[model samples]
Target: MKNRTILLTGGGTAGHVSLNQALIPELKNLGFNVEYIGSKDGIESGLIPDSFPDVPYHAIASGKLRRYFSVKNFTDPVRVGAGLVQALNVIRKTKPVAIFSKGGFVSVPVAMAGKLMSVPVIIHESDVTPGLANKIAMPFANHIFTVFKETLKHVPKEKSTCTGSVIRSELMDGSAAKGKEICNFNNDLPVLMVMGGSQGSAVINEAIRSNLTALLKQYNVIHLCGKGNADSSLMDLANYKQFEYVTHELPHLLHMTDFVVSRAGSNSIFEFLALKKPMLLIPLSKLKSRGDQILNARLFQQQGFAHVVEEEELTPERFLAEMQKLQMDEDLLVDAMTNAESPKTAYEMAKLVAAHTKN
Candidate 1:
């Protein structure tokens, strides 16, 4: 069977790549060949090639247009302008049937190139709040998919579809039983999963530390500590599992977890929902993160999948108190998560893009 070529572009973080990753398998199942286009700096560089060796990888150079100022921002436009030209050359060479973008600064060039080349350019917005890049690209896109209904306000309604988030489907119905055994966890006890996105969350780690002794008495903790936090032994308890990184065991980790504590990155949010686990989201507000995490958590809070604890309010006491509330209300939490849209996300997104692209 001949495969239709799809040129997928997106990534500055795992949020973008995770969505891209989900679609690759789905698109391929439909007898389509997928190629990736992203920048050198993002996690996509390492993840894309490793995850899908069958796919061709293309790289573009770009400097982020941060919401805040730096010397880099001043020079980014020229670099990105060059990227647009280079990406145009790639689109001309590959002649892909369609382009799917998970918008970030890096996606700008290729999305623009697709527009110039008269290719169908589809974008998927992963957050409740659209980022600066996606907001700009909306007008030019043939179709745009957003995870949040709120994003429609920022993006042109004509170009956008609220499809929820695209996540790996098997996660929706998978059992955490296997993970419980692999992690050497006890099923009788509740397991709390703490992760700070793909890179790890230091604030979450510190908060856990301050409250660890208290938390351990009630919950078995599984912490993905990025690559640099103290080892699992730091817990000084027998019930905790800690890892600097656990790419292979991520699903299992989520499966075995009774609940989650994570940053507001969209990938983590959807994954937790896919697992139907309750979560406490602590958004990054200290830097130029632009409160994407905050917005993500706020939406889920409105839906009852999570509770938002701002960094300022995220002390050991508050963290523990929040967990206690969730523990007390576990059944309601489960009901809320089970009712949330998920598992069919990639299929929903793929169907939308396919129909639009065909038109």
Candidate 2:
């Protein structure tokens, strides 16, 4: 009999872990044993365990893969090698029929180990362009899944499929009333949610904080300021709430939000689109990323789903102007989103992954 086991790996950021989190329960409901392998220090390490206490988590050594010269570059390869060894051992012990990876530096060694052990490796790339980790892991994968059709051009097309975005089911069931209650706000003003991805963005934080007084004049603000970034001075302020991070509360928060200002990670942008929330997207600068968010943001803008403000141009004036524009274009953006292709449900995506397992 085929081993009814599946191993999931990914995590440097919440983006890498979010899809896996969405998949775990579905995979388990499909009667497959789901386990996770991720970096010992990645957000996944805590997220997976906290979210699903039953699933076994295997932490492995991982090092960031960087293009720029770093003193750690020479040493990181050593950690990668160690991660490969640890992953191989985990695979041997668990004997998973398949390994599913969401693209992150922590996943590279897991994919390599899966290939070396003759297990089928599947990768999911959420960006319009493949990330460096996915690029490195592609050749080792039996098949690749992409959130955007545009990504097919960057990866080997023969083994790749555009599965589109997979949204978490619970996100759809959020209570807007509960969301407002969570923030202790009322319907007196429109709600604006500002997020800077899972880790938070200093630039975005500063922009929002500096303009908080002006923003609170017109809209109640929910700011996910990232871990360690929240200002104590702002804690007592009415019409504004700040969180370092939130997991279960995210859906409710999003549900109550009238507008969003966020970095253009594919997962987040897609969630906003799915919810028909008008948004102003501030993509990470090329200096900070491989320009994937730039592509993600531009595509959303082209489709009239969001307003794009490149990080380099995100001055206070520009930020406020874009917010006004987003407000003015809300109906058009919502209409565009309503007509856009629907995202695959977690159950559907789970079945797709399960189909590729070894029998």
Predicted structure with the largest lDDT when compared to the true one: 2
Superposed by TM-score, candidate 2 places the C-alpha of residue 101 at a distance from the truth, in angstroms, of: 0.3
TM-score per candidate, chains pooled:
0.92, 0.98
lDDT score of model 1? 0.80
Q: Write the per-residue lDDT of candidate 1 for residues 1-359, one digit (tens) a residue.
A: 24567899888777777778878888887767789998986888888999899999888987687777688887999989988988888887887878998887888888888888889989888887788888777766898887787888887787778887667775655557777776676547788888876777778889987887888888888888786775645745678888877665677677767888888888778778877788888888856477888888888888888877898878778888888888787788789988876455676666676776532
Q: For each candidate, how many residue pairs have backbone atoms clashing (under 3 Å)?
A: 0, 0
Query: Which regions of candidate 2 fall more than 4 Å away from where they truly are?
Result: 1-3
Candidate 1 regions with alpha-carbon error over 4 angstroms: 1-3, 173-175, 230-237, 286-288, 341-343
| Candidate 1, position 69, lDDT | 60
Clashing pairs in model 1?
none
